[model samples]
Structure formats: structure tokens, C-alpha cells
Target: MLKFVIPAVALAAAASTPVSALEVTKTATIAAAPDTVWKTIGAFCGIGDWHPVVEKCALSKKGDKEQRTLTLKGGGTLLEEEQARDDKAMSYTYTILEGPLPVSDYKSTIMVAKDGSGSKVTWSGNFKAKGAPDNKAQEAIGGVYEAGLKGLSEKAK
Candidate 1:
């Protein structure tokens, strides 16, 4: 009886704790130079230009934060706010304000760096699953990153 009670108590405590966030990261090597890669994707709304699924991007300002509303090809929209940006570092970070993604508290960063004679682009994100299992959410984000990186690579060439 004592052993069973202890195990049940532990299970209850664990169930009450919040779920940990999951992360997905994807990288690609581009034939272009770092500076040139940054110039191609540096703008806040440039995702529309290089992300294959993005159909349109509308930029707007809210207080000091720059926000972009991305209209996706199949008819979904994502509203994201720029959290941090540094052209010198060739990196920018953003958070989802509202979107159809299967994750919550989603924050992502994209960075470009010199790799040998070309550039390496990295895109990573952290978030908790929402209305879906962790693996599903991770897969969704991974697919998005993969598609975007592929598009970016093509544009850089």
C-alpha cells in the first residue's frame, strides 16, 4: 500500500508540471557570400521573397516592434513580431503573435555566417505543442524551416 501510494503521488506531481518546450533547427549552405545572403534576407518582410510557402508579406509597426503578417500559399496567415535584429551579426529573431502553427510561444531565429567561401544559414525555434503532440509540432516547424532554407538557397544562387 505504501509503495503504491508513493508512486501515485509522484505521478500526480509530474502531471501537474508544465510541459517542456521543444526545439527544431535546420541549416543549409548557400553558394553566396555571407554579406550577400544577409542582403537577400535581411529585411523584416523579406520572408515573402525567399520562403516558398509565403504568398505575401505585409509589414506594419506596433510601438517600436516591427511586425509582419505572412499570407501563406494555401490560405493561412501568420502574424509575427520582430524580437531582435542585427544586420552586423546577420541574424534576426522573431516570435509568433498569432498563427495556425501547432505550437505556442514560438520564437525563432535565422542567421547567416561565413562557411569557407560560401554562407551557412541556420534557422531554429523553440515552442510548446498546442492541440497536438510534441512530435507533430516539431515536424511542422521542421518542414517549414526546410522549405524556407531551400528557397533561400535557390534565391542566393
Candidate 2:
């Protein structure tokens, strides 16, 4: 009885570790040029057309600067503060300010590369869920991301 109890406790401890440290990445090839795709994606408050879950996005703040807020559908909002950007690198990172999502330290960048006559776009991020994000939470985030990329591909063309 003692042996079984010890092992069970150890297993539980390992399972309880916070599910924070997850990276979800998705990529696609767009028919349009990288500049065109970037223009559509980098547009603040214009994400509603691409992100399926984001019913609308309005600029909570304005400026060619860091830190901005975007309100989402279903009573959730996110704050993004820019980390870096370069036309040559085609990448940027932002931290989240507020939201219902489990992720805490969330930052992502979209990179573009010339693939033959088209452009290859890669979206990647690393974050840790506030607590433990169930499978449903993970799937929801992933689906939204994929939908956004697909929408960009279609609209950019």
C-alpha cells in the first residue's frame, strides 16, 4: 500500500506542473508578394477579416509605437506591445497584456521568405498557459491561428 501511494503522488506532482511553455507554429505559402501579405496582417483593428474568432478588432491605442490593445469577440481582449521589427527580417514580437486565454508570456513573430514566385509565411510563438490549458484550449488557439493564415492567403491573392 505504501509503495503504490508513493508512486501515485509522484506522478500527480509531475502532471500538475503548469502547462506554460508551449509553442504553436503554422506556415503557409501565399500567392501574393510578402509586402502585400504583411500589409494585410500588420494592419491593426483590421484582424476581424482574417481571424475567425476575432469578431472585431478596434485600436485601443494608436501610434507607430509599442503597446496596443485589441478587443476580441466573446468578451476577451489582448494587449500587444511590440518587441522588434525589421523590413529586412520580416519579424516582430509582442507581449500579451490581458485576456481569458491561459497563456501568460506570449510572443509571436511572422516571418516571410521568397519561395519561388510566391512568399512563404511562418507564424510562431512561445507562451505558457496561466495554469493548465486543457486540450480544448490548445485546439481553440491553434484553430484561430490557422484560420487567420488561411484568410490572409485568400485575401492577399
Candidate 3:
């Protein structure tokens, strides 16, 4: 994963006094098959409905693929560009094109695994920031991940 590195002064100007990169992982068990879960997770427009923190996602044209601009209830927008997509591999990667947190080179992948009676969904990402330190950003990102995962799990029921 490529880390988004932000310069200290610029980072402070962007968010607050401190900025740092964040790595987050969140997982949840869904009472659906991997394919069913994937259908929901990969649906760009339906994301906000399942992810509690996201109010909506605005999509724009980007050649053959699409671009996503996610508005979070926390007052920031996430701009992500799809880097790769493979239904056979059941994986896709996205890079943060722009964001308020001074996040750069932000990349993430969602992995699905069959677990007996259900499926496990994992959301993971890596990125860097410029203002504070790495740990703070990590915590914030973790919270985001947890909230999304929890919402998905609830909706999956």
C-alpha cells in the first residue's frame, strides 16, 4: 500500500494543528453469501444507505469507470478514484484523489471470506497525513472503519 505523506505545515493548514497518516481495518460477519455481500458493498450509490456515517456519495464520469465523492456526516468529503477492479478476484483498489485530511496515496481493498454459516467482510486502508502524528490518524481512520462495518452488519441482517 502506498502511504499518503503530507508536509507538516500544509497538513496543519488543511485540517488543524496536527495531521498524520492512518491505517484502518474493520471486519464484520454477514448472514449472506460472499456474492450477496459483494453486491451491496460494491454498489456505489447504495453505500451511504448501508454505511451509517456516509450521508451520500456523488459519482462523476471517469472514462470507462466511475469516480466517487463521498460526503461523511463528520463534515469532510472523501474523493476516491477507482484504481483496479476484478470480480473474479473479488477485489478492487482505490486511491484518494483528494480530501480535507491531507490524505495522499490513500489506497484500500475489501476482502471477503467464507466463514461457515456466514461471510466475513474486511475493509482495510493505508494512508499518511502531515500535521500531527501517525497514531492519531490511525485512530480516526479506525473509527470510520468500525462505524461502516457495524452499519453494514446491521443492514445485512
Segments in model 3 whose C-alpha atoms lie over 4 Å from true places: 1-22
Query: What is the descending TM-score order?
Result: 1, 3, 2
TM-score of model 3 (CA atoms): 0.76
TM-score for model 2? 0.72
lDDT of 2 by residue, 5-70 (tens): 999999999899754567888899998888777777775445667665676665654366566566
Considering every candidate listed, which one attains the maximal TM-score?
1
TM-score of each: 0.88, 0.72, 0.76
Candidate 3 lDDT tens digits, 1-157 = 1244456556667786324445788888889887777777775555677889788898886887667898988698987777777776666777778776645557888766787888898889988854646776677777777888787777764
Ranking by lDDT: 1, 3, 2
Instruction: Estimate the lDDT of model 3.
Output: 0.74
Candidate 1 has a TM-score of 0.88
Candidate 1: the clashing residue pairs are none
* Cα-based lDDT at residue 99, candidate 1: 91
Question: How far is 91's C-alpha from truth in model 3 (Å)?
Answer: 2.3
Each prediction's whole-model lDDT (CA): 0.95, 0.72, 0.74
Best candidate, lDDT: 1
User: Which one wins by lDDT: 2 or 3?
Assistant: 3
Q: Which lDDT value does model 3 have at 69?
A: 91
User: In model 2, where do residues sit more than 4 Å from their true spots?
Assistant: 1-20, 43-49, 60-65, 134-137
